[model samples]
Target: MNGHSGNVFVLSAPSGTGKSTLAKRLVKDVPDLDFSISFTTRAPRAGETDGKDYFFVDDATFDRMIRTGGLVEWVEVYGHKYGTGKEWVSAHLAAGKDILLDIETQGARNVHGTLPDAVMIFLIPPSAEELSNRLRSRGRDPEAEIQVRLDYAKHELCEYPAYDYLVVNDTLDRAYRDLESIVLATRLRRERMGDTAQRILEGF
Candidate 1:
């Protein structure tokens, strides 16, 4: 076993809160941090690569993975299944590489149960009105679907208190900075820095 394990950072937010964009940016800015690519039983959309965006699998394959314990957490959303691979996460953490999981609230909670050391951050819009506007701007969902998402967003907001940090994503640049800061701060925690501290003390 490795002497050290890296941190798992979970980012959760409502559908229209820009959490995905922020997560991508944070991974690009942070060194040695990788974004966890999820496996989904949904078809790839335009411009989305098979491995980059998600590992697209069929229902049978997804079910087989679940039965064999290959997935860490699996959830069905809008009739499609999405899950994180257990082996991939374990290997990275064992190698002392931090990982970023941009999943929904339920997935975050599930990961926390297994990896209790994970740092969960909740992102929210500046105002409910802004959230609604952002959702509408996507132009992909129908009116009814949009309403469903907005209602779900309200419920998601109530879970913010359970997160380690809450970031308001009113401005992209500011939100990215805040997210980056949280990752850096977690890395500098005493528990994570124990080996480095020991090495420094030995030199003195």
Candidate 2:
């Protein structure tokens, strides 16, 4: 990791909140917005491609990554591990690229601690009932596992105060609009746009 700029945008949500879908669409539509594909200890779900959806690894490899400082932020959820790699993010940011992290609440906190300039957003479902319904629609987790996720969500929701923005994923398109607005707005801040403004001022 070299001189990192810490121009990171982090999105955190409980399971079934549509965070992953939004993050993907945001990256695709936004210029200079790179998706930070995370490392995970969980087995790949149906339709999840390795190195695309996630870098799935075993426990030993994950532990070694933790020990060697390879991860920027990592956390254990539902007995599985998830992490963002340090080198990838630092390299991108150092090269003047913006990165979007789709992560859990704990990992978001950790990233904020490291990159104080990073923007944090929390995405939530419209209601607990809807949250449960979305999980069911995925058909990835069994009934008991869904219940476990819901219970964890109850605890995770308490961390909303830590986020800079809150997006309720009631409608996919509308939520994306709000998310896009936040990112675009952040880019216009003086800290980010100062160089461009300075050059224009000098020309004048």
Strongest candidate by TM-score: 1
Candidate 2 residue-pair clash tally:
0
lDDT of 1 by residue, 128-170 (tens): 9999999999997898999999999998889887799999998
The C-alpha local distance difference test score for the whole of candidate 2 amounts to 0.90
lDDT of 1: 0.89
Candidate 2 stretches with Cα past 4 Å from truth are 1-6
Clashing pairs in 1: none
The whole-model lDDT of each prediction reads 0.89, 0.90
Q: With candidate 1 superimposed using the best TM-score fit, by how many Å does residue 155's alpha carbon deviate from the native?
A: 1.9
